[model samples]
Target: MEVEKMLHMKGGNEDTSYSKNSLLQRKVISMTECIIKEAITDIYCATNCPKTIVMADLGCSSGPNTLLVSNAFINIINEISLKMGHESLEIQIYLNDLPGNDFNTIFLSLPKFVKNLRKDLCMSNPSPPSCYFNGLPGSFYKRLFPSKSIHFVHSSYSLMWLSQVPHIQETNKGNIYMSTTSPPSVIKAYHQQFKSDFSMFLKCRANEIVSGGRMVLTILGRRNEDPCSKECCYIWELLAMALNDMVIEGLIEEKKMDSFNIPQYTPCSKEVKDEVEKEGSFTINCLEVSEVNWDANTDNRLNLPDKNGGYNVAKCMRAVAEPLLASHFGESIIEEVFIRYRKIITERMSKEKTQFINVTVSMTRKA
Candidate 1:
């Protein structure tokens, strides 16, 4: 599959769009709020309160959460400048993602976003930083900015996606991701792909970020060393089961199921640290793992399988995966596939509680 052309969250603001269904991602962002502030704060301290700050949000998919982190950065820097009596600070942020991303939606929302930002800042300081926003469209696994140009970097829920699917000799039959049934070679192939992609990411960013700059990355990761751990791979497992059932019912072809594999890998925390060390461009400031419930929201209802919780989880998964699935399996089966997936999710949720493991890491570009 051509991952760069196909890999994007559902776009626009419709019911099925990523903009509406990205609450879980929003929650993850909220979880990392303090770290982002600290990273930005550290940048200010290390750089002796520079007059201009340049930052980029890598893989910044369009949605409510797309600008949430940027807003925080502006707010934090503004407050710090006020405290230090530094009145003339400038912030330049580049919002980046793949070319297929919904940059229009984000661009259209900026007027209201800036209006609210200025209104909020009016209370404390008469003037805010001269902030500028630009949309950068491309892959981040390669260089996207001029050397030593960026002062701070942030990426949320993106590094888990590999640049391309792992090339494996084994077929990984009946599974769309790493699974218990997958051969050991398939597991090794996925891990190697992640290592290569992440190393390239570090190398690219190392060139762009100035010495002593800070970066914070939030990734969907696993607690267990095993690649097929439930937290990381069960979501895809259930979807594969739904597809296999469709094939049996003659709704889709069996070969499509056998040939498909998600171009993503959820690494353990150790894997992340090892890659950072191997790349040798940044020093790890802090790395921690946190767990978020599969239905990371508050919808007080009966806890029955096939109920509200499962429906929400299904919608969230669809928001992120529907585009990729449609590109390969055909769009006609998408609605049906998720319908079945919702049922499976509810059934599984009823039996045992499951959570997504998130790895939040802060790093500094070594001087």
Candidate 2:
């Protein structure tokens, strides 16, 4: 299959499956899984269309969580396939990400996952999900899938980040993304990037998604009407503080700071809904707001033992924030920064365990 070659290319990686507890990751798969089942079943029931279904998961990173999502998708597709009496229907699944994702983990885990799925299929009383899986490697901003080849497209937390780092020119010696801190220009720039990337995704998928393909996008976003709310993301706040501390210490010059933009942007759901509706390429099926308490909780099991101590406040943030903090703040500072962040998250969660989590927006292409 050419998709296999696609996986081995410069920006290739094995498909990372995600688990339900992964908050944003699991939710993205869940949203996609729902829409795919609905789209396939509806088309088959109404028009008795051919059952060749192509599905793609964007920004699937390496880990057990990736496989978990894959398994759920396969199950759903297989159930739909059986109901439609299309045992031989093609369910081509694609795992897409940037060039440097951890493909080794995906490659190593696939055999075991497939074997387990087959075993479960044989033993289960119910029919299995009908689908074939492939790892399609590349930036989602570019054309990865063939024209009109995809039936469903899924991405989580990924779309919030730009395909490449946004160029930030130092104006008046301030970081572009951070200096504004939810200023009109900052939000506008982020919204623009999202519109561009998402619009491109629709254009590429328009040809591939048959007449009624579905796309589900889940991302970290703000609940407050104001994008600049401090509570929106304590992670960003902690980083800002860390950077400020650095500046105070004379570790890095203020003039060179703008280059350190967090290659990511989290726009509000309302902003996203307006943009998709305005694009007119697709119809909005639903926009859901869920809490994403990535911060730690107070479950002091023997193993976890409140691992971060009172830092449970910073619960689930360690995954994404760790890399950036490590990179800019230095390996030595990550532990310190996280310690402080956790202290804040722990206290914050005590009052409210979950901040409005990621929002999953589902849309179907217009015929």
Candidate 3:
């Protein structure tokens, strides 16, 4: 599958759109806000107070979270400026995602975001700085901005996606991602892919980010070194099982399933640190790993006393994975497949508590 073209969140304001089902991502962002603040503070302290600040949020998918994060940064910068006695700072904010993301929704919401931003700043003793927001659509695996132009870079729950599937994974049949049953070769392939992609990511950012600038990244990752750990990839394993059931029911072809692989990997902290050292462009300031329940953002309505948690999980998965799954398995079976997936996850949840391990890292460009 062409991952760049196929990998996008469900668009529009429909029930399955990413805007509706992105509560988990929102929770992740909220959890990492303090880390983000620290990174921005580091940048402010290390550099002279400049008249302009350029910042970018990579893989900023559409929805409330996009502007939500931007506003957070603006607030932080304003607060620091007030303490520092700086009069006016111009802020340039860049929102980046794949070319296929829903930029329209974000664009439409900007006026309201700015209006609220102005209102909030007026309520403060010192007025907030003027800010400009623009959408830059492309892959962050390559250059997305001019050299040394960005002051702060932030990415949440996005770096786990590999630039593309590993070439050696054709042998990884019956599985869409790394699992306990995957051979050593498949695991090695995933690790190598992450190393290559992350190295490039650091290289690109190293050029775009100014000296002393900081980057804060929050990604889905594993606690242990093993790539096949359940906490890292059990969700994909369950998804593969759902597809297998569809194949048995003559709903999807087995060959299609065999050929499809998710272009994502959850790297361990050691792996991430190793790549940063190898790339030789950034100094790691902090690295932390935290776990959140699989249904971290399930609403009360969905979390009724008797409701199955898998239903909410399935909905979240569909919002993000539907585009790719529909491309391969056909749109007709998207609903049926998720139905089966819900049952599988529900059964598993009843037996055990599944959680996703998130890794948050803070770094600064080498001087």
Candidate 4:
């Protein structure tokens, strides 16, 4: 499948859009604030306190989280300026995503976003940096900036997506991602694909990032080496179960289910470290894992699908995965699939606690 064209979060500021359902992503971003601050501090010192700092946030999907990275930089840099008794710096930010991403929504929100950002900065520092925003639409797997230009880079909840689905020799029946039932070859294929894509990402960024520049990335990941571990793959497994039920009920074709697979991977920490070492362009600074509840950002945690918790989880997943499903399975079953998914999540969460394992890695460009 053409993932670049088909892979995008549900757009706009609607009830089910990514803008409304991205609190989980916001939480993930917040979790990395310290790492981001450290990286920025190091970059500032290493680059001799650059006056013009160019940064990019890859896979910057639309919504409030879209500008969160820039805001963090502005605040952190201003703090650094005060500590070092240096003048305010100029900040240039490039917001990047796939061509199909909702850049329009982000652009439309920019006027108010900047005004609020500046107002907040004024309270902290009278002379805040002059920040500029640019929307660049492209795949991060390839070059997106001039060589040795960007001073910092940040991406959250995005690297797990492969450039495209792995080409397996056999059909991964009854599953859309690596699962316990998947054959050994299926897991190997996914690992190889992730290695290739991640290596390319590092290599591309190596060219784009100046020496001493830093990058911080957050990905859906697993603590265990097992590809089929619940931490990483259970959500998709539940989604596949919903699809299988629809197939049995004549709502969707079994053939379609058998043919489809997600172009994503949840790597273990070892996998990430290995890929970075193999790529030979960046040095891993820190790698840590955190867990987020499936039913986060809501108080109705005890209730299942019948209440708000499970329903909210389902909506969040839909906001992120609906476009991929619509492109491959047809948009007709989107609503029904999520309805079943919500119930499954509620039942499972009631019996057992399931959470998304997020792997956050901070790295510096090799000199």
What digit string (tens of lDDT, one per residue) describes model 4 on residues 78-147? 8888678777579999999999999999889899988988898888787888889999999999999999
Q: Model 3: which ten-residue window has the lowest total lDDT?
A: 297-306
- State candidate 4's TM-score: 0.96
lDDT tens digits by residue: candidate 3, 20-71: 8887888889888888999887787788978999899999999868876788
TM-scores for every predicted model: 0.97, 0.78, 0.96, 0.96
TM-score: the better of candidates 1 and 3: 1
The order of the candidates by lDDT, greatest first, is: 1, 4, 3, 2
Deviation in Å, model 1, residue 249 alpha carbon: 1.3
Q: Candidate 1: minimum summed lDDT over ten consecutive residues — where?
A: 298-307
State how far residue 1 of model 3 sits from its true place (Å): 1.8
Error of 3 at 360 (Å): 0.7
Cα error of candidate 1 at position 68, Å: 0.4
Q: Which numbered prediction scores highest in lDDT against the true structure?
A: 1
lDDT of 2 by residue, 1-367 (tens): 1221222211222121122124445544554556555654554444354566666788887665556555655666566556556665555678877665667667777888888887776564254445567776677777786676766776767777765444433241334243344445555565566678767766676666656777777877776656555445555665565555566677655654544556566667887887777677888887877653343233323223344434433434555545454555456665655565565655654554344357678778788
Q: What is candidate 1's lDDT per residue for 1-367, written digit by digit as tens?
A: 9999999999988998899989889889999999999999999878888889998999999988999999999999999988888877899999999998999999999999989988887778877798899999999999999999999999999999999999988999989999999999999999999999999999999999999999999999998988888889998999999999998999989888878999999988999999999899999999999987788675324433334888989999999999899999999999999999999988998888777999999999999
Decide which is better by TM-score, 2 or 4. Answer: 4
Q: What is the C-alpha RMSD of each candidate to the true structure, in Å?
A: 1.9, 6.0, 2.2, 2.0
In candidate 1, which residue ranges exceed 4 Å CA deviation? 298-307
Shift in Å, residue 312, candidate 1: 0.3
